[model samples]
Target: MSHPIYLTKSDLKTARSCTTKLYYKKLGYPTVDRVDGYTRILADGNFIVSKIAHLLYPDGIYISANLKTEESLINAAQETIAYLQQDNVILFEPVLYHNHKLARADILVKQGDRTEIIEIRAKGFDSKAHEDLIRYRKLSYFRNKRTGKVGGEWRYIIEDVAYQVGILQEMLAQHLPDLQIEIAPYLLVPDRAKTTSIDNLASYFQIQRLSTHRNSFSKFNGIAVNFTGDVQEIEKDQFLTKVSIETEVAELIEPTLTSAQKYLDYLIEQSSEIFAPISKGCKSCEYRASDRDDRDGFRQCWGDLADVEPHVLDLYQMGRIGGHETPLVNEMILQGKASMFDVPLEVLDDDTYSYRQLIQIEYTQKNKEWVSEQLPTILKQIEYPIHFIDFETSRMVIPYRAGMQTYEQVAFQWSCHTIAEPEAPAIQTEWLDLENTFPNFQFAESLMEVLGDRGTILTWATHENSVLRDIYYQMQVYGYHNPQLQTWLANTAKLGTKGKSNLVDMNALTLKHYFHPLMKGRTSLKCVLPAIWKTNPYLHEIPDFQQYYREVDGEILSPYDVLPQLQIGDRIQVVNEGAGAMLAYQDLMFGENRNLGIDNQAMRSQWEELLYQYCRLDTMAMVIIWKHWQKLCAEVL
Candidate 1:
């Protein structure tokens, strides 16, 4: 029952990141949460593919035995030696253990005493993969001597056979010279089509049933399954198709399964480092959940700590938190590098401060609470009833109209909860079910009627004003004449350009004014809503929000044939079916509306009430936050 003494992929990755992290991981440091579903799928897929590669060269020695431990690496190295001794072509997973360290080679191919190590990745060859393979080969070369084996050759194998060939070949040419191996042309293996008949036979065989708990489709009876055929047909159609290439490789080399098991046992004996946190290991380590305590402390002192740091500038790069950027502005204050005035109390207290504090100071101040409080004061100097309005619109890509960007916002449904009198509760009014044809114009007309001539119009985000302004401009381009449109334009233009005016973003507000313990980790409206109101907007039972969006977006039409019973005051207005199709389009452009309740009609009604309550609560949250900002402004300004 002794723990294995081998380095895992994660351990190697951690070693790359920082030796300290690796050291901590080896000492059994607590990590983070379990891998998400997508990552799990990838890990499983890689293991399956690796096994298939092993089947391709059957007589190959398995350097590592414990699929879960690092010692299997030695098994792989020993397998390579056996293959070389027999002058047999070998397919193997090689584990290189040297100086009490371990690493894995995805596939090792030995042809007549010449061996080449292959690293298999499910991803197509990319620059990152190129860099990783080079590093892996170097590690293998250094460790091969410790395991009493020669580092013969190296190759990087990836999934996209056609497209990645040139890329891989080029990288091999560039990096393999130092290792004294002339780079051969890279090989790409396209995904083999699983014939319908083979799939049926495989399913019928239910070979997986033998190891019910193990979902390995590659390994059967301690041998990799590379080829599939009826026992009678095997002699007639030996090479009909290389269905089980891995199994075929296994059969050719014909290493005893018992020997493979011994190598596996050795790997278990040698692998002793508790999954540690090396800098490189963080890139894709699954055992991070075990390092949660260290990560949390790092996150608190730094900003958002990540397991991996990207070498390139991309979305992935942004996930990394390291070096100078680790210590947040507030943390700088705690470290006595900045003064109190340099960081606001609200900034320090905000629940989303972890993320917001990452941005520069000035931009962070323009949030909901700040605008709401400042607006009332700014309007005190003028003589017009202040109007606070909120609007919901949908946009389309691929130009629903000519002369539009590939994606343009076409306002369809608007719910404006207006606050006219300063002391009065906001009155609610909304316009939905607009015909798709000329929705913008109709929306403009309705807007002008409610807005009147002289009031400071307010919205939650500057994007709202921009949406209106853009529609007005589009109307002019289309030669639609309206005097009110002109007025709306002049008024909005005086405020600012679209998305930069007297509008508010509640996201900004919460980041500035509030910091509930419940809101500690998230800033999205969905997260913020429940944190402030103790309820979720999407808690409904009818017309599942996903289906609603799907119907609206034209992914599919509403099932009118399966119409539910309509109760009193329930208005089921099926506007132009095509118009509603815009809903699905909107959903895709934004995101699936998870807030829609379930599919039952009675539950749908209850959900409708819940939606209303949620929306009302949103406005109420605005009000409460506004009051907090007013008090802070009075005290600070």
Candidate 2:
């Protein structure tokens, strides 16, 4: 059996992030967490963009056409060399191999003695805004920030391009000196500033997954790309330059190529399982997911390194405290002093919010939870008839309507739980639209209808505010004339114009006045809910919350953990997180959820019920959390 390709772009990025990841990744250890469908869709969307992007040149050769399997990468390299020998051929996914390392450039334009290297990325960057961010001191830069500047999240992307370029140049000098590698590394990203000439440009290319893999030339695994040009235009219009990668890498802002090569050389030298010291980056590590037999690679790696169950990496926002202006945690990591146990005593006592950080550390160490001293006083501000609203929405690559920009806001379903009084039955109302129609305006209208003029409209985070604000703009765009909507939206929604919002932010509320030991340091609703649910037994009896509580074999369960599975075509999909909900919406919208005549009405009914149950659980979760807070308040008051 041949060895799987270990050193790729992804591995290089991972190693750049933290050397430990390369070790774990190459070991074939499955991530404790599963990659969501939404992420998969996004990657494929980038793939589709690359395909259309190549059509812009219309001269690039696809070396990937026959290189389908692991074994085929070898053949692909040979094909790339053959194409390189030819006259000025544009190569899409141009294969470059150096020793065991391999790379496939998104687009390699080989023109006689000069070759241009282009990388197609889905990330968007406004050059003007980027410069502003740099000036505001909000962004830190390299030795030279003015010329060809790059900072913030683009650091990783720059490293990736640099690595690819370095590999190509080295390979060229050694293999094909005749091909003068005048490699001008450029990033072809979404030009948000440019408008597409064609209408519904996004919907033209439909991406469907095939159960079996297509040959190498296929766009992606299981995905069939059938593009229908101009969903709204009668004339054959193209968007080659109009929707091109508007933001190009500046000429002089390039980081040291030696820096990229150094990491690559180290990665090549390091064998499998290279253990690294803990760092702040471990907080968001994807490898945190456990594998077969409940073995967590993230925890195990950190545990062995620090010999502490909960380390400094778990400290809430450890890296953000000094802002981008300083690098305290980074300096510590460099000195091999980055760990929960190694956290400086002064570091925990310096900030205004240091009290909470100290409390978190204590509780984590003692294996207990901490509640704020002012929990009850803060909870007393609540009024009766609190409305808990939750929306499941999506921002698609393809616009649903003509003139709609890519990733236009679309709210598909919303659920609300009305608590008229302290003991009211916690009535539930919901609206879901999945038919072949835009649901944003209808969603807003239905939500407004359910929430009449009097009560504190509540939600877990600021996202709800942003959603309503987008809907307000959408209403104006669609020529929806309703003064009542304008009035209601202005008063309750976070208006971009007035910079005001009436909807109570529960996450902000939780952060200021509440902290459950179980919640660690994060304030997301899911984390907060689980942290409070099992602790309060009274909540387990409330009808709205009762269904979520059950002691099975002495183990407590979470409601979010037990949502039903959805049949999307032949595949069974579980709609659990926000990502899952988005994927589910896509499946339904694309007819993947519609079984062979599964009864139009019946299927719609099932979809409504499925969607409703998921959202109802969200609003109901708010109720349970509210009741739990009420109980905690009573204890303190």
Candidate 3:
């Protein structure tokens, strides 16, 4: 079906980012251009949370429809009207319209004369954060730091509600002119104070593929039957709360929505004419080149028109300025600057991502790797038998076992590359636990056994250290005492503000000691591995790393491509990374049904092996990066 041209809340929300996307979205991109796996999981999660939140209002009507086809849009609108015709109806997913705009209000509480609009989002919130965002952002919503989209999390949420309120307010004026009008807008979000009574609160509802439809609740379509078991009953008020109107929010909403509509109209008229330059926001763009349509949204904006390659957006943490409020490079791009080369020469001081960004941009323009003067001294300080450790973890909405809470850190896997001496071969060892058991303590214990009272344990980032600390806290809370684990954690791990950390953060090393031209501005393993792998032929010759290299049509690919394809029913599920692995783990543990023919044992075995390789790649990736650093350090010495 041809994609509908009507502007919805999503389009309204997204147009704040890039108006050009609205054009591609309205015109429709090919099915090949879309990858439904990762986002579909998130959509399902949102739906499940919404459903659970709906339990708070027992009398609330769902206004159900397929929502995947044109038929559903018509039906949903009709269903909403039918519900609205009655007095005092609490409706969920009510369809509202304003001119060419459409929105599915999450929940609407209507009295004889007063109506309240509440949007229930699965995204968590802190009240102070929300309040501060609203207070600060309404002032800057149009200023220099504004994310082209209505920026800030709470700002966007409130903007959405404000948008809905604007539409409903306009419609009600005509539809029920005599009713004494009172309109209130709210956002219902997961309470920060609420803790999941069950281990896997997010696991209960399994998500299906997103409906090919654009503005639809396809995730919840007939999903109620698929959910098994029940989460511990959360106190409705405790779990979810109406956003307090402690500040003046109503004024902010109307102005934002007006701007949203103005932009929407302009973009619609401009269509593909909207020249969206390659900006920092492009870093997370999902649009890809397609089969039927070769020039996808990203390529059209970046490749075809921008005439820029390996652009400024590629710079690490290039999105934000010194403060996270304003998007740095995008604002620059909007002002006609397109490349990192366009950034003026400047002093880059300290650890703020902005400083890192400026440093990267300068280096990229110079076309040289920037090695700090402290490299030799830093390298010398490192104790030998350096253990390079990397962890692969999954924290899903559902907890799998007892004593686990929703989205709790479960360290299911770890890989360590040990260099015992200067000339000795790098020995690789790893551990993975998908044994339908809680592996946090076991993971810590295994890591300790391998690490011993180590000489310099290295991790790419603070993530590993944070995971270990969480394990220590869990040990304390679970009342499972292991003095050995606790002592090792105290000695080796950086606990809070104290503890002498034997572990060195390799990411800090990268930030302080190294930069490669190919790294652009990224410090992530995703960018780092490819940058190092493509440049250093030493990796191609190493037996331990040989399996990872496979030249496909003259372009090398990571071993992630070689993992087993999962056949669930008629669909071949791609196990791409951690998100996919988490879904697979949840399916194997909780989604088992003998009649469905998803071989529980086979699937578990497949995921176990895949997780091992992915984790091993992570650790080995650290080793490869270290090797590169070592080479440069040796040369300097």
Best by TM-score: 2
Query: For residue 54, what is the lDDT in candidate 1?
Result: 46
Error of 3 at 506 (Å): 1.8
Model 3 over residues 1-637: C-alpha lDDT tens digits? 1344466777776677777666667667543425354664555556666777676677888775655555556666767766766779998888876555677788888887667787777666555555555587753221225443434566766677777777777666766566565777776765444454554444455444433444354335534424554534533224455674313356566686687677666654664445566666676765656666765667666654255655666656555443456556766666766666665445234355555676677677687767787887887788888899987676654444544444567887788899998857788889877556677999999999999995889998788888888888889877878998898887777778865667798888888678888887667776777777877777788887787788879877755664456664456665656566555555554444212345455655655565566677677788877777777778877
Give the winner by lDDT: 3
* TM-scores of the candidates in the order shown: 0.37, 0.83, 0.80
RMSD for each model, in Å, please?
16.9, 4.8, 5.4
* Model 3: lDDT of residue 161: 74
Residue-by-residue lDDT tens digits, candidate 1, 417-471: 5556655555666554322243677777787777666656554545566777777
> Ten-residue segment with the worst summed lDDT in candidate 2?
238-247
> What global local distance difference test value does model 3 have?
0.67
Tell me the number of clashing residue pairs for each predicted model: 66, 10, 12
Q: What's model 2's TM-score?
A: 0.83
